[model samples]
Target: MSEAARETARFAALAEQSNVGPHTLDQLQADIRRVVTTYPSRPIEPLFHEVRELRDRAFNLLEGRQAPHHTRDLYLAAGLLCGVLANASFDLNRYHEAETQARAAFLCGELAGHNGLRAWLRGLQSLIAYWDGRPRDAVQLAHAGMEFVPENGTAHIRLASISARAWGQLGHRTEALAALRQADEHRERLTPDIEHDDPGGMMSFPLAKQHLYAGTTHLWLRDPTSLTHAKEAANQAIQLYQADPPERRRLGELALARVDLAQVHLATGDLDAAADQGHTVLGLAATRRTESIDKGLDRLARHLNEGPAATSPTAIGLREAITHHRARALPPGETT
Candidate 1:
């Protein structure tokens, strides 16, 4: 082609590109980071709205022809928004909606060919599957994610933890333990000082979160030895969470850790301790409660009913408290 024709074509292409500048992309990224980091400290209802707004903005920017440099950034921002929507929807008891958002996030990640985003989205899908009572699917998704981030990172750690939980839920103790060990190894190699694709907050998995998963996995395994491990892990998770600053702290995680402690105490026949921990967890913000936490409490309740505590005064009081708190915690028209 002639130089003049080539110049004309280049100018036309550049003119067609949308006005999503680098500053705009950076701001969107920062907003997404804030949404993820503040997730544990706020209500899901508000976050859901915020995520939707972000998603819409991202979709708009992606509409017209975009500069090559802007394409990946737009995809990453959209993926992050979808991820936040998925998690917030799940917290609001909208399981199907959560799954839909998770799939959208996965697609965005694929478009960007972002390993970290893909891995994190897979972990989210695994979590939703686990809550929806599909342990096999959860295990598959978690393992698939692990393939993308084999080296130590938040995605690797989260995928491993979720995989361990899925294996335990499926009664595969060997695989569960292996996954847990793998998570620990990744954690050891993970440097908090380094900036990863997905930093702390919802995208990253910390040691405290790993302990919570360990506790949950042990509880699912239901072995006498496992109960001891569960109790210890739960305690460790609680301690680690408590050590964080107020803004850095996640109320939902603290509640989960407390419930895990309650479950451990109940399993060990410490009725008073179990009741206290249960009450403490129940006192946390109900609007922020996740399905996982609800499921854990359900297991604890069942344990209380089946054991000798069934007729004990402490158990009776605890049951009543749970019922009352659940009624208040869950939104109207929602059930545990």
Candidate 2:
């Protein structure tokens, strides 16, 4: 076949892949990666701008600046925006920001009567809460959100994943595994047709997200097997982020790097590398102020203090940096 024909065929395949159902953050990102890779010369900025505009319009409508006639479209747009922003925040280790955006999206979705979108937003919020050291809250939110959406929707999958993480944090291994099983079962039932019914806001429900969540759940459970799952998800996410523009993709890279370093250090008992990664994540957190990254850093610090890793210079440096930063941020008398 001619080169042009080959490119056309490749693009077609990517389009087909992008059509896979139950849009999740991971799925949408994977689709974006597939499209950009297949058509390297294509202008991605335009697409990003278009989606962002839609989100802005939706927010405007929600604020009553725009007529209510466009409520559905606005809700859908907000949902999509939420997914995009949440994914970006996750990539950048700004879990708190991701949670806030996701919550806003879900509220808009609820007003628009988009149950699926609301569910997805709730799941995103739950993940943020879990990462921020609020496991009980995560569990509560996930359970509550699941009631609003279909069992097989992307939202359900997210809720299940978050639930698993919360359960793991609560030291309930069996419950966490059960949630994982449910997530897997939902994945099996997914289809391309479901994408069309995605309630406008939750667009990309990719398989990589499933792996990412599974890996996270395993991490919380402190199981070695979870490392493999996380590694697979991180690799896919890293590839997708690399395929996009740097400004648009830095968050994903940070997330991939954070997870990779965390797992590796945990496995190898290398406190210094883990501490370095924690500090790197803190730098990212400075930009987004996401609670997840902050809490993760705190957790790493605590772990280092308790283990042989505490003696490492890198660990000490990270701890000092965190303390200094926190101390500087507080009022004079509030310093502890």
Tell me how many clashing residue pairs each candidate has: 0, 10
lDDT of each: 0.82, 0.60
lDDT of 2: 0.60
lDDT of 1: 0.82
Q: Model 1 reaches what TM-score against the true structure?
A: 0.92
RMSD of each: 2.9, 13.8
- Give the runs in model 1 whose Cα sits over 4 Å from its true position: 1-16, 150-152, 191-199, 329-336
Q: Give the poorly placed runs of model 2, Cα more than 4 Å off.
A: 1-71, 74-108, 150-153, 196-205, 223-247, 250-253, 256-260, 272-276, 279-289, 321-336
Summarize candidate 1's per-residue lDDT along 51-115 as a digit string, tens digits: 78889999998986678768888998898888888888787778888888889988998888788
lDDT digits (tens) for residues 1-336 of candidate 2? 699999999987765542122343344444434432322122223433444554564455466533343545556556656665664455345556566667666766777777776777677677667766789999999998878955344667768877987998897889988999998887777777663334322244445556656666666666567656655555565565556565444453255347555655756676656666667666755543433444555666676677766767776787787666555331111100
TM for every model, in the order presented, reads 0.92, 0.61
Using lDDT, give the best candidate's number.
1
Span of 10 residues, lowest total lDDT, candidate 1: 327-336
Best candidate according to TM-score: 1
